[model samples]
Target: MENHALKSWPDVAPKLVAVAAGRAPADTVLKGGAWVNVHTREVLENHDIAIAEGRFAYCGPDASHCIGPDTQVIDCAGQYMIPGLCDAHMHIESGMLTPAEFARAVAPHGTTSMFTDPHEIANVMGLEGVRLMHDEALLQPINIFTQMPSCAPSAPGLETTGFEITPDDVAEAMTWPGIIGLGEMMNFPGVVNADPKMLAEIAATQRAGKAVGGHYASPDLGPAFHAYAAGGPADDHEGTCEADAIARTRQGMRHMMRLGSAWYDVETQITAVTEKGLDPRNFILCTDDCHSGTLVNDGHMNRVVRHAIECGCDPLIALQMATINTATHFGLERELGSISPGRRADVILTSDLGTLPIHRVIARGVTVAIEGEMKVDCPHLDWPAHARDTVHMGRALSGADFEIAAPAGANHVTANVIGVVENQAPTKALKAELKVQDGLVPGDPEQDVCQIALVERHQATGGVVNAFVSGFGYTGQMAMASTVAHDSHHMIVVGTSHADMALAANRLQEVGGGVTIWKDGKELALVELPIAGLMSDAPATEVAAKADKMVQAMEACGCTLNNAYMQHSLLALVVIPELRISDLGLVDVRTFELTPLFDEGQDQ
Candidate 1:
C-alpha cells in the first residue's frame, strides 16, 4: 500500500520558503483564479497558488516570481478555486463497492478527502475486515482515512454479529497506519451508562490523540445525552432535528448534519446555523450512508453541501461545513481541507458555489479528475477468498422456515411490527391485530403488514426469528432478502408470501451473498456482492446499475417509499429506535431489550 502520511514540513521547509520568496521554481502554479480562503472565510480574487512536492507552497496575489522555465501553469479563468470537499463521517461498505470503486464513483463530485468508518465490514469479518478496508483506502489517490471500528455488534446482548470487536482490537487498530480514530460509538446508552468496555475504547482513541466519533441515536437530551457528550465523542452525525443539533453544539460537540441515500437529516439540522444562528464552526456536513445509485447519480459530499445551502446556509459556510470544519474536527486542519500554504494541493475549480459543478479536480498536485470523469486509476486490493465467501446457511431454507405459528386457542393477536419510516433511520413501534389462519398468522397486505424474518447466517445456527413489519406498501406476491442487514449482517427476508421469501433467502446463499428480490416464486433482480456480502468488487457503475434494477423491482411490487432498500437493510440495526429485528427476536430499541412478538390480547 502507498504511504499517504504527510512528510515532515521541516524536510520541505527550505524549498517552500524559497518558492514563497521567488528563489525557487515551484512544480505547478495555478494562476488567475479566485482562491476560496477557508481560514478567513472569504473569497479573494485573482490569486495564484504555487505547489511543490504535492503541497501548496504559496497562495497569494501573484506567483510570477515562483514560476521558472519548467513550471507548469494552469489558467483557472472564471473559476472558484475551492478546497476539495471532505466527508467527515461515513461508511465505505454502505456504497456496496470496494474502497477503490467507491473512490472512483465519488471523485468526479470533488470529494478529495474522506473519513470512513468500516464498522459494517468489521461486524462480519472483525479486525481483519477493517484492515482490508484500511489497506484498500490507502491505495486510493485521495485522503481516505480509516476509523477503527468501535462497535461491531453495536449493542451487545441486543444483537449478535458474525465477529465481535473487542477493546483490544480498538487499541491495536489505533497503532495502524492511516487510522484516524475510533469509529462511531453506536452504543450511546453504554457510554452514558459508563460501560467499562465502551469507555476503554474511547480512552484508547483519546490516548492516541485521535478523534472519538459519536452516534447518539436516542432523542433524550437529558442527563444521559449530556453524559454521552461528556464521555469523549468528539463529533456526532446522528442528529435528526434542529434541537438535536443545538444540543450537540451547545455541549461542545461538532454537530455533523448528514444527507445520504435515505437519511434526510441536513435539512432539519442545518437550522442550527441557518436559522438559530449557532456558530457555524461547530457544525459539519457528512453522508452517513449512501448506496451505489446515490453515489453514481445524485452525488456525495457535493449533494450534502448543496442541500445545506438550500436550507438557508451561506455558500461559504456550507463549504466550511464540508471542508475546513471537518478537517479541524479530525485534527487534520494543517494537512488538508483548505487552499492554504503548507496544505495538500487538493482543490476543485468550479464556476458556481450554490449549484456546485466539478469542472476540474486536483489532488496532491495532480489532476485526478476533470469534467465529471476520472483521469487516474484507483488501485484495488486482492481480496482473500474468505472475504468473498461469507454467507453461511447451515441448511437450505424452506417455506416452513418462515411460518409463524399462532398461539393455541387464539383466533387473533396483536403482533409487534417493525415499521419502516420513509427516508429516516428511526422506525415506528407499531402493533397490528391479525387473524390467525390454520394455526398460523398470515401477513395482511390490506393492513400494510408483512412478515419479516431474521435468518441466522453466522455459525449456521439455522435460527430464524420470525416477526411482522408494516409499511413498504408491498401488494404483490413478492419478497426481498439481503445479507447486508445492519450490525449483525444477517440475512433479513421480508414478504407476504412464505414461498417467495424462501426463494429469495436461498438465492442469496447460492450467490455467496447479495440482495435478491423474488416475485411469483421467481427471481426478479439480483446484485451479486460476493465480497463480504456487503460490497461488490464490480465497478461502481455495474453495481449501481444492478441496484437501480433492485429499486425498480421494489417499485414494481407496489412499494413507493424512497430508498426502500436502505430501510430494508437497516431493519436489523438494533441500536436505532424504535423497533428492529435480530437473531434473538423483535427488539424495542427504545428499551434496548428483546420484546415478545405478540402483545397481550384476547381472541375474537
Candidate 2:
C-alpha cells in the first residue's frame, strides 16, 4: 500500500472542507467523546471528530452533518479522545526489531508518531544503513521521521566506528525525502571546541532549516555548557537533574526527559517543571532507547506519560509534554500533536485520562488498532545478505583472549573500573585493588567487579581491550556478550570466567550477531539480531520473549539490576560518563582521553 498518509495538507484540503461543510461524507467520524484540546489545555465533552483523506476535517461539539450511510462512526461512548502519543527522541534499533515490527508493537499502546535516530545502524552500516532504516520507517502507517546521524563514532578520536559519517553526509541526508533533521550531536566536546567538521555538520543542518538533535551528556553547567548551547542544537535528552532541564530550557533548547528500558532520567528532571514551576512547553517526554521487552511488555510513550503523572505532574500536563510539546519541538505542531483541523487524523480512545488504557488507536483516518489488537499491517523490508552478515571476529577467541596481564612481579594492582550507575548512563570512574593470580588480574565477584572486554568486530584484526567493571553483582562462571554495543556497535563481553566470556563472544559471531549469555560453559540464552548485528528480523513479540529470557539469565547469574542487560551493552560505549571501554583502551570520559588500566605504586 502507498504511504500517502503523510501527504501534503493541501492535497486533502478539498475533501476535508467538503466533509466539514456537510457537502460530502467523511471517511470516518468519531462521536460522543470528550475531546482533548491540547491547544487550549482543556477537555470539551460531547465532541465529534470528522476525518477525511487521512486528515482531521472538523472537531467540534457536533459532526452529524458530515455523516453519511457509508461513513463509519466509532462510538467513543464517553471515552477520552486524546491526540496520539509522539516520541520526540528514540532509536528504532534499540527495540532489537526492524521499524515494521517496532511500529506494530507500539501502535496498540497509542504511539502514532516517532522521531527516530538511526545512529546505531549508521555506526554499523553507514549512510546505506540509515537509508535502509529510513525507507522501512516511511512504509509504516504512523509518522517515523528519520534524523541523519551527526556522530557515527559518537565520540570521535575516543572510539572508532565501522563506518564514519562526514559533513558531506549530513548535507546530503538533509535533502532526503523523509529526513527531518540531524540526529543527536553526540560529539559535544567537538562542538564546544569548535571542531571544524562538527561545526560544518551543524551548519549544514541549520542551512537546510532542520532541527539538530543534541546530546550534552556532561553535568558541568558552566562555560562548556553555554558553549554547547551556542553551537546550535535545538533539543537535548542527556539531562539527568532538574538543573540540567532548567538550563537547557532557559537557553531556548527543548529539555527532553526520557524513560527508556533502563534509563530512568525522567523522575529527577521532571522536577524542573513540577517543583520549580518551569514552563511545561519547554519540556517533552520521550523514550530515548527501549529494548523489545520494554516496548512490548511495558508501553511506549504511554508509559512515560504515566510516569510523569506519578511524579506529581497533572495528567493533562503530562499528555501535553508527550504530544504538543514534542510536536512543537520538531516544528510539526500544525501537522500533528492535537485533535485539531488540518492535522493528521491520529487519536486515541481511553477510558480514563490518568490511568490511560489505550482502548483504540486511529491513525490517518483509519482504525489501526483496538483493544490491544492490530487492525492493520506494518510493512517490512527484505534485508540483504550484507546487512545480515555483520559480525567479523577474525579468528576463534580462547580463554587467553580475555586475559588482563599484570605488570612484572606484581602481586596486586590498583586498577580503574568502570562503575555502572543504576538506571543512569553515566559511569563512575572507580578504583579497585585487585590481587594478581598467576601474573593475571582476576575479577572479584565479592566486590561486584567483573572483567569487561571490547572486541573489535569491524576489522578482521583480533583486538580485545579488557578492563574491570563494578555494579552488576555477577557471580559464578557466567558471561554476557552483545554486538549491540552503543554508538560504536562493537562486541562487548563481560564475565567472571575467561572461558565463559570467550564462549559468549564466539556464540555471537557464530550467529552472525546478537546478545548471548553463558553459564557454566553452556549457552543459556541468545537473541539473534542478524540485521547489522543491531536488530532482529523476527517479530517484536518473539524478540521480546527472547530478550526476557536474556534478562532472566542475567538474574540467575546473581546480577540484579533493572535491565542489567542494557547496562552490559553500554559498558563499551566510550561517549557518556566517567569511564568506558573501547578498541583503543579504557577511556576516561571525563577527560575524553585513554587512561592506563593499572595505576602507579602497584606491588611490582
Candidate 3:
C-alpha cells in the first residue's frame, strides 16, 4: 500500500526550493486570494500559493515566477483562502460508516484532516479491529490519523467489553504509520490514582513521542483533575463549561471544545477564550461524535467553526481553533495545519469567515471537493465476513426476559433511574416511585418513566440488567434497541412495553447488529450497522438516510430530546457521569460503583 502520509520536509525540501526559486514549474498555483494567516492571525490580501509534490512551495503576495506553461492555475477570485479544517478529536465509527465513507461525507465540508479514535471498534474486535480502521484510514485521500485506544472497557469493573486494550496494544500501535497518539484516556480515576496500567500506556505513547488524548469527564476541578493533568495527557475534549476549559488550558492542556450532533459544548466552553481572555492558542475545536445524518445534512469541522463564530467568537480566532490550534495539539502543525511553504497543500475557499460556505476544498494539492460535493473518490477496505457477524444473543428474547420481578410482596419502589440530558454526554441520576403490577414492576409512560435494559451480546450471556430511564419522553408501546452502546458495545433496549422491547432486541440480533425500533410489536425503523455492530461499510448518504428515518421514528415514539439516538447510545458509557447502565448493572458514575435499582426500604 502506498503510504498516503505527506512526505517529510527533508524529502520534499529540494523540490519545494526549486519551485519557489522558479527553477522548476509548480504543479498547481492558486492565485489572487486572501490568505488567512493563522500563524500571525491576519488575512493578507491578493496572495498566491504555489504547490509542488502535494506540498506548498510558495505562499506570498505573488507567485507569478513559480508558474510555468504547464502549471494548473486556478483563480480564487479574492476568496478567503483558509487552512483546511481539522477535527482535533472524533470517532469514525460514530458516523455509522467506515473510515472511507466518513471521509467521503466530511471532505465536502472542507474537513481535510481528522484525528480519530477507533476505540469504539476496539471494544468489539480488539487490536485487530483498530488495525483495520487504521489501515483503511491511510487509504483515504484526506488525512485520518488514528489514535491507539487507551481504554477499551473504559472503566474497569464498572463495565465489561468484548476485548480489552492493554499497554502492549498501545506500544504496538505507536509503530503504525497512521497512528498519531494514544486515544482518549477515559480512565481519569486510574490516572489520578497512579494506576500502573494506565500510566504504562501513557508511558508507551510518551516514549514514542506522540500526543496522549484525555477525557476528564468529572466536573470537579479539585486535586483529582490536577492529578489527571499531571498524568501526561496533552489534550482533553470533555470540557463542557467555561471553568473546565479554563482549568484544562491553565494546566497546559489544549481544551478541545466540541459541537457534534448532540454535544453542544463549544458555546459554553469557548467563553474561556471569548470572555476570560485566555490565549486562543490553547483552545481547539472538535466533534467528539457525529452521526451520519449530521455529516450529510449539517457540516463537520466546518459546522464547529461556524458554531464557535456564532457563539460570540471572532471569525479569525474560531478558524484558528479549528485549524492551527488542532494541528499544533497533535504535533502536526508544520506538516498539515497551516498554508506555510512546508505544509501539505490543504486549503479551502470561503466567501465569508463567519457564515462560512465552502466553495472549494484542496487537500494535498488536489481538488477533493467543490460546492458541497465530493470531487474525489475515497477508497474502501475489504472487510472480512467475521467483522459483519458480531451479534450473539444466544437465543431469541421474549417478554418474560424483560420482566423486572418485584422483591417478594413489594407493591411499590423508589427506583434509581438514568436521566437523559439533551445535547450532552453526562446523564442524571434520578429517583422515581414506581408501582408493581402482577408481581412485576412496570414502566409508567404517563410519568415519562420507561424500562431500560442492558442485554449482554458480547458473550451471549443472556443476562438482562434492568433499570429505569426518564427524559426521553417516550410514550405508548414502543422500544428502541441499539447494538452501538458506548464502551461495552452491548445491546441497550428502552421501551414501555416488554413485548416491543423483546421484538426490538430480537430484530437487532437477527440482522447481525445495528439499531432497531419497534412499536406495537412491529418494526418501525432499522439502520443495519453490521460491521462489529458499530459501523457500516455502506455509503455515508445511504447510511444517513436510514439514520434520518431512525430519528423520525424516535420522534414518532414521542422522544423530544435533541438527538435522542445519541443519548440512547451513551446510556452504557460508564466513563461519563452521573448515571449509566452496563452489562454489569446500573452504574452510579459519580461514585463509580454499581448500585442496586431500588432504594433501600422503598420496596416495602
lDDT of 2 by residue, 546-566 (tens): 999999999999988998888
Top model number, lDDT:
3
Tell me the RMSD of model 1 versus the true structure: 1.1
Q: In candidate 3, residue 323 scores what lDDT?
A: 91
Query: In candidate 1, what are the lDDT values of residues 206-307, reduced to their tens digit?
Result: 999999999999999999999999999998988899999999989999989989999999888887788788999999999999999999999999999999
Q: What tens digits encode model 3's per-residue C-alpha lDDT throughout 1-604?
A: 5547457789989999999998999999999999999999999999999999899999998999999999999998759999999999999999999999999999999999999999999999999999999999999999999999999899999888999999998999999999999999999999999999999999999999999999999999999999999999999989889999999989999889999999999888888888999999999999999999999999899999999999999999999998998888888888888999989999999999889999999999999999988998898889999999889888899999899988887999888999899999999999889999898998788788999999998888888999999999998899999999998899999998999999999999999889999989888899999999989888999999999899999999999788999999999999999999998899998989999998887546
Give all candidate RMSDs, comma-separated. 1.1, 1.0, 1.0
